[model samples]
Target chain A: MRALFLSLAATTILAGIAQAEPAIMPLDRATILAGSPFDFKIELDQVHAAADVAVTVNGQPYASVFGKPAEFVAEEKGKDGKVLGSALIARGLSIAKPGDYTVAVTAGTETKSVTWTVYGTPAVPTAKNVIFLLGDGLSVAHRTAARIMSKGMHDGKADGRLAMDDLDHMAFIGTSSTHSIATDSANTMSAYMTGHKSRVNALGVYADRTPSSLDDPKVETIAEALRRTTKKSVGIVSTAEIEDATPAAVVSHTRKRADKAEIVGMIYDVKPEVVLGGGSAYFLKSGIPGSKRKDDKDYISLFRDAGYTVATTATELKAADGSNSGKILGLFHTGNMDTKLDRSFLKTGTVDKFPDQPGLVDMTQTALDQLSKNPDGFFLMVEGASIDKMSHPMDWDRAVIETIEFDQAVGVAKDFARTHPDTLIVVAGDHTHGVSLIGTIDDDKPGTEMRDKVGVYDDAGYPNYTDADHDGYPDKIDVSRRLAIFSSNFPDYYETFRPKMDGPFEPAVKTETGDYVANEAYKDVPGAVLRVGNLPKSADTAVHAVDDVVLQATGPGSDEFKGYMEQSDVYRVLADAFALGAAQK
Target chain B: MPFALRRRQFLAALPALASLPRMARAEAPELTFDQLYGGYSALGLTFSDKVKLLDGQSVRIRGFMAPPLKAEAQFFVLTRVPMALCPFCSTDADWPDNIVVVYLEHRQTFVQPNRTIEVTGRLEHGSWVDPDTGFVSQLRLRDASFGLV
Candidate 1:
């Protein structure tokens, strides 16, 4: 035992400080934009004297390229005595050229090297206006089901058209993150907005070893680049809280997306010319009745002081336009805005409190009107956020209605693009969900069981939904025959045959063991059945799918988005269109 | 004469000691979760009349324990419904403002979320940032203990 202990101690010591070396900032295969600033840091495996370490870019010394010496720390402390070696940190560094740059570091046998493609765009701009519309977690089934539901299908061929069907360009975007295949909105949208693929929950920054949420190495956001490189205005509109992941991705850098208070501060720091959405909780001071902030920062007053015309209602939004207000800060609800079912039909959720919330179509049109006034043009991003929100609850009817609403918002953008031919309208989803419409659930079928009532193959008859208003949305959600939408991944949940009219479905509830189980609330629904979950019991809701989301675009720079591309490549098109890398002499 | 004086002093002390049992640790007024907030509005939630009346007093509330941020969390959130999703499940999920944090007096086994129980502790209100998690909550129950009812 003593002899074995001696060998074990030797082995433990070797592995102790011998874990994988810390990854440097602007990591391997990083594509840095020309003229844009980034933080540079090199972490070593073990402590080294300043004279012992050497870093070279393409066989040239690091100081020769950056023109500034890096500050070195001998020994850096990690979480609980996990000794990360010596480190060098340099803030706000840039390489303004279009070429392959190789970076190599040598710190006594612990050698690591990385390559970067610092690329620039053409000298001239490709588009004047950019309308980027993202449907959160949009899957192929939603589009196919929406086409069939909204427009009739006969002999495998029927339908007037969908708003996105006519787009001239298409791309299969790979939405994987730098860290994992499964990603959240922060990384995915950050890839789109910043031309960088960061780790999950990180936006516009490399996830670093630093404990400070704000101290991570940063990348320039598209909004910031546009502000720095051009005179164009910027706008952001989302159904989620303004500080939520996708909207916050326009301008934010944090290791965690839950830093909502800090995200609010970041938004104020950039101060996008026009901002509108829910989540007033962070804008109010801590003492305010509904404030979610712990700080005394009153963003509501701050935005007003910064020349924004704040509107709390749809009526006020309309009035603000007539009030000659060029910049509008619309806060329609405190949290995420109410879905269409609650806002128009059920009168539940938070609709009773925020009665005058504007629909996406109206919001899009109003935003276009305000943005068109900018002579230098504008870049507007409008998000249909709730498609994913309602889908998580397993509320199919509500989710489909929201899809229709989102499509209508697309229609609004298309209409504006028609008038403004110089505008580039790119409509796509940030990610795909596991949801699909397999068949119709016919109530008239002679069966007590819900699954027995499902119509398959040729027997799947057309659903009789009346569009008496001719406004596109069905008059009622509880028709005799309707689409049976199902998710590929979910926790233990009761499968109720009918739409949940009470509100969004709480599919799973936490048990004493900290594991999620089928919510007993729906146990009494007429044909409800408890479906044992295939996912881990810890999963409380349905998860996102790895399937590819369809992307379509039209206008000047849209021609570049062809075939398959990574989500990060979408940013390159955006940057090239705006000429973020063009020399601004 | 000295012995008689000492006897009189001892007799007076007996009455003072008798009143101590009645005067110490008096029972506090009861306040419920519904009574902690007056109104729910988009602008902000207002603390209830009962909350103002019983501020800094001992109060008791009955609710289910929502799943904690981590398995070893010292404080568990008391909620009206078993949170469908753990607020700490992901950065995406956030706790509702109505949540009451229960810092137990001693470690206790976490009960099923569907179960209801009563918590008694000193009522504390105002924004307090959790140093460990950076979770900012406006209302909390400090030095609390609870049991299944």
Candidate 2:
């Protein structure tokens, strides 16, 4: 398989080198959903007259195949009015047939040809609801640690299983984006939401050469598809800001995910029935103290006028669940919500300011209760956002504890699935972080040095954590013996083998030279040692790993996810489960 | 005399010089980062009474200097913690809520980022946008000068 992939990559590069043809959107061998709307575009290498250019599909004129005429521009100007090339665009085009389509474009001697495989699903649906739970940047080590920490371990094995461990079907998902092997949360989740792979930092659109983020080729997002073909309600829940990349991918189209202000307008455009998370900062006017917007448009008031109940805290969210309008918009924090370790266990990390933030479990339950009110069923997406946020800073304790909290949310979804067997629950991660638990760190076995206290293979024993209060979290994070996890890549930082009892860790900071350096705040800790970074000086923290993410699923239509699949392929299974191709109207 | 002893003797003579009634006295109030905000909510933050009272008055604050937005600029950001991202370089980097923008009184070389520095200036509180750079800040310190603490 490795050899085949490398050779195919080599052949594609050689073909591109051999031809000076126009670049096209949806590159060769693309698998498109039948009858799904997409923007078709072709970029010619040189300016050409509309009469001189010819486009064909399957030996027929493109106009005859798509039943529409393409808009042609003799010269496409780039940034600062520089002439890039000539272009042709056809918007809102869909192919209704299930077959291989060969699209060829020619202008004088410049020519390019690509093929797409259009697939159709069964006419009948296999599931009534689809719940996708994504733990951003989740990795195997996080799962292992969450299981060991929450469920406890004995005699090197038999503790118990996590909510995700017992899924009936599992697969290894390749999460590489279109442009590179490495991936971020934006494109990775975008591919899952829209069955098309895109470049990094892009969501629901192909990365184009244009400077304008909005002009990129657009694709139909899952939420838009549900609105188009079904009567089902849609809900988006996350611990991060709702306008963040993961949740925004459900109904957004921009080449850049950082276009967050624009993303708020996109969310308003769709106006899903339930939207819960942090990020009220973008909804406020500029005069408001916590407002992050440069404009004066108040989205909170806009949504309220649109008949949506807005909740700002846990108590308000619970109250708004009884809203007669059946639409709830909960903004718990101005930024990312505080984690469970801060809100429940430690009572640190901005908990004083926002004391009543809800946990992911409670938010998920609220979403389920409201979304299920619709008789036609619903499509819900929940995200455990801080699992990735804390991992980037190499805060292993916080990251692992966040994983535990995420698993508890998964348990809630599983409980709902048990009652509604027709519901499909898909649990996966957008990408993987390079983190792993090596062994135990036993304070009892140590001299003065913390490094000497690290217990390796034979000396490693089970961690001593208690759940005396019956809460899922360990009673205390400052255990005498604890798991030692580390990231493969990290910025310059001081390695302290203990939990940050104050707040989330800030391992590195930027210097005046624009390079990252180890923060000296932790330098005074008794056994802390400075570890030179393995990453570049420009990187502020650890980066995402290129390894494949593990995807697990249960309920109806899960058997289809059995082998290796691309991140985009996961969407095909989802569409098939709901029969999104058939017109329910 | 040793450099330390010489510096100590010079500092020791400052009180005697202050005894002269003709010299002006500095009355800069001290403030901490925790005292800047009274409450936080999703709607917005409320300024503490101390911050409102010290507005337009000379005050001293201690913090670490965040990386400046431009190589040659009139101001820098002072944060309770060292910043993780260069806001000028990364489009996605966000400033913390409690940052204090310090407009320098004169051109000075930037110091190492690992040490804490004390800044003295007139405190200004409001939502202000810098005209030249278009940088936005809720709190600011005007004509600020700093020294290593």
Candidate 3:
């Protein structure tokens, strides 16, 4: 027995030795924009003396290639004085050459190697302006539903096509993050804003084993790169909070997307010329009634002091548009703005509180008008964020209506692109949802139960929705016959076939046992049925699906966005389009 | 004293206080969710005159209890509607603008989140950060007791 115990101890020691290899940042096969700045870090498995550690780039000393020496820490400490390991940090390092560069790190007996491609673009730019439109959690069903609901459908064909449908180029974008097969808005949009695929919840940085969300190895965002290389302006517009993941990815560099207050400071650091969205709560001091911050810093007054005209309503946004200040900060709601279905016709949700909030179309047009004042160029990111927000709750009508609103916003961009031929418009989604439009639900069917009214295959006739106002949205979405959309995954929910006219759907509620149960509030709906959840009991709502997002682009640089490509590769095409490698100014 | 011990001592005296309250008590005014907000804007929300008049007075309100912050926590958030997400458990979750914090008079097991409960307590207003939890609440109910309607 003593001999067996000694052998077991020896086996454990050997396993530990086999796993002790150094970790290098700018992970293997990383694609970096040439001349763009990034941080290089090496975390050794064990504490090592400064003299014993060596790092080399392409067979040359690290300082010779990066033009600066790294700061070495003999032992990194944790909260309880726990020795984590030895680490080396090099900030703001760049490579001007366009080729694969291998980095090798050696710390005593431990060694690790990683290869990165430093890519450069042509000297001349192909596009003067770029408009990137992301419909958050957009899936094929949303486009199909939006087209059917907004444009209407005849016997077999759509009455008209969406503005996004007419784009010149298309690609299937793989949106998996570095750490998981599934992706979130932060990592997916961060990949577009920075030429790196990070783990979930991370933006413009690689997820490290640090406890602090802000101490991760950093990557330069597109907004930062544009500022570094050009004299153009930047504009961010979204229906969700301005500091939400999709918009925040353009300027933030944190390991957690929930660092919204810090993200506000990051946005201030970049200072996008025109910023419009619904995160006013974070900008207020903590003592204020509607404030969501934990600090006393008031960002609204700060932005005003910096010459940004603050607008809180649609009328105020239009009024600001007339001014020559050339900068606008619009916070229409304290949180995410009400969806179009609520803001336009229903007058529900938080619309009664924020009565005059601008829709995505109005915000996009205002951003374009203000951004065009710059003769050099501008990069504007317009996000239809509520498509995901409503989807999580299984609110199909609201999500489809938001998609219609998003398409109308696309029409506004396309109209601008028509006149300004040099503008490049790229429309895509950060990720997809587990939603699909199978057929139609007709109230005319002979049945007391709503599920019996669902018509599939040939019985699934086109919906009857009228758009007499010509506002590009259905006059009313709660028509007798409507599109049937369902999520593939959901918690215990009441599947009411009819549209939720009273307000947005709340399909599930948490129980005392910390498990989600079907919300009994909707139990009395005409034909509501309790559908047992397929997801884990811990899930409160439907989750995002791991699917390829469809991307479409138009104008000069659009040809590069073809074939199946990783989400990070799309950023390379954007960099090449504006020739961001070499300074344009 | 330890919080658990202090709480037990408070609970021990609750029955005597309740017997005295039955002798001379006026019916508490009931407040609604809509009555809490006088005006709303992107800048801030104003408390209604009704809410101001009833400050520190016994009031009854009906709302759904959100999932408790912890099994042993002494407070829970009261929301106008059933909360689908627990803000404390989910990293990305955030509370709606008009949640009311309820500090219980005594420790009690959490009730079903979907059921509406009527809570009676002294209405407290203004920004107050909890000393133990550091939670910021604009409106609160002190010494609250709740029962399902």
Using lDDT, give the best candidate's number.
3
Model 1, range A98-205, lDDT digits (tens) per residue? 799888888887788899889899889888889999988777877776776666676678555778878889999988888788887889999899888898889889
Candidate 2 vs candidate 3: the DockQ winner is: 3
Highest TM-score model number? 3
Q: Assess each prediction's global lDDT (C-alpha) against the native.
A: 0.82, 0.88, 0.91
Number of backbone-clashing residue pairs for each candidate, in the order shown: 6, 0, 0
Clashing pairs in 2: none
TM-score of each: 0.88, 0.93, 0.94
Scored against the true structure, residue A404 in model 3 reaches a CA lDDT of 88
Model 3 chain A, poorest ten-residue lDDT window? A16-25
Error of 3 at A36 (Å): 1.1
**Alpha-carbon error at A123 in model 2, in Å?**
1.5
The CAPRI-style docking tier of model 3 reads medium
Docking class of 1: acceptable
Worst 10 contiguous positions by lDDT, candidate 2 chain A:
A19-28
